[model samples]
Target: MRLFYPRGSDHEVTRLVRSDAAAVATLHREDFARPWTTTEFDELLRQNTVFGFAARVIGQPKAPLAGFVLARLAADEAEVLTIAVARAARRLGLGRALMEALLRRLHALRAETLFLEVDETNDPAVHLYRRLGFVEVARRPGYYGGGSEGKSDALVMRLDLGKAPVSR
Candidate 1:
């Protein structure tokens, strides 16, 4: 997947590797309240069913990653663990591209379903998933955050990879 920005950018997506842990962690920290540690990323990459990829811009120093997606597969079912794009890279097609790439992988693996959880307050994320053919199948009240920040509901969305709409 080319560095999947919505527009005004051209980059490519590369298979996520153990070496990408730091960059992934950095991005996760900036965007997520509970970010995965570098060690965690390393461990996930070691799992046979876990898969991820990093999007990077061309000619950039050290090729800083612009976005990423991670997921796992098991017994015809898969779950999207996370997908994120840098703040500077938002509104680009990176998120969609990541989903498309993951969908391709799931399809190749014979996965029948893909599930993900999104904060109900994340309009962009919810919209993106809906656009990608995911449907709300369940919901968890106060599933995210803790303490003073208050809890947020998580919408459990499902996409039947076998029936996913073709990317345009």
Candidate 2:
């Protein structure tokens, strides 16, 4: 199990595994409207194309995760499926660390590009992606429902792996 600390963070980034399904599912429910189930997470974790990272407090390996990121890689492309941090853990750099870990793994795998769709109204997530060098590529109107303003547009963002991330 490869585990490392992201610079300036107290959390450890570790390889996500099948047993993490239940914990990640619980975390997912905190942020998503229609959260994925543990069974769904299990299936995804079993897939060869899917991989992810989980963040946990240093020295507390058995404790609940602070955050996680799930992604799928096919050929030279990768797409983030979902990412979530516990409400209590927000602003502690867990989300950014999970995403950065994914990026580093994708780079090592020689992935050419990465893509993700985020709710346009999610300012924090949008800003995080922008800081990571992701740019808007397209949009899907009413892609998500039941937001404060009813439905919301989804912003499709892309990052070319050849370029360095924008310095924060």
lDDT of each: 0.85, 0.90
Which candidate leads the pack in lDDT?
2
Tell me the TM-score of each prediction against the true structure: 0.91, 0.93
Which candidate ranks first by TM-score, i.e. highest?
Answer: 2
Q: Write the per-residue lDDT of candidate 2 for residues 1-168, one digit (tens) a residue.
A: 655676677789999999999999999998887889999999999999999999988888789889999999999999999998888888878788889889988988889999999999899899889998999999999998864669989999999988847222
lDDT of 1 by residue, 60-124 (tens): 73767889899999899999998899989888788887788788778878899999999998999
Candidate 1 Cα errors over 4 Å, as ranges:
1-8, 146-149
**Candidate 2 residue pairs in clash (backbone atoms < 3 Å):** none
